[model samples]
Target: MSRNLRTALIFGGFISLIGAAFYPIYFRPLTRLEEYKKEQAINRAGIVQEDVQPPGLKVWSDPFGRK
Candidate 1:
């Protein structure tokens, strides 16, 4: 094989190996995290929740005289 072809083949093989190694380490965790976030959003949705926060603990809605 020619030198240029050999160099290209080596680079391509290296890239494929890196990508294969990365799939489980990086991509899988990211996908799992996205799935977990989706589950959390579903679980934390207001429509499904039963308990509500009291006025004193409510955020940004000051009923008392603060101003």
Candidate 2:
């Protein structure tokens, strides 16, 4: 192979390998954490009679209104 082609292939291969190694260790954990949070909220709602809202699901009628 030519020098430039070999260099490009090596660089591309290295980036692919790094992404493959990182996805499970980094991205998978974050995904599982989100799932766990949802499960916890479901359990909390089941245990309580009142409805439970997840962290980001709040609605406000007035944006600037005081609480």
Per model, state how many residue pairs clash: 0, 0
**Candidate 2, lDDT over the whole model:** 0.69
**What TM-score, computed on C-alpha atoms, does each candidate reach?**
0.45, 0.45
Q: Pick out the ten consecutive residues of candidate 2 with the lowest summed lDDT.
A: 57-66
> CA RMSD for every model?
12.5, 10.5
Candidate 1 achieves a global lDDT of 0.69
Candidate 1 runs further than 4 Å off: 34-67
Each candidate's lDDT (Cα)?
A: 0.69, 0.69
Give me the displacement of residue 27 in model 2, in angstroms.
0.9
Error of 1 at 17 (Å): 0.7
* For model 1, the run of ten residues with the poorest summed lDDT: 57-66
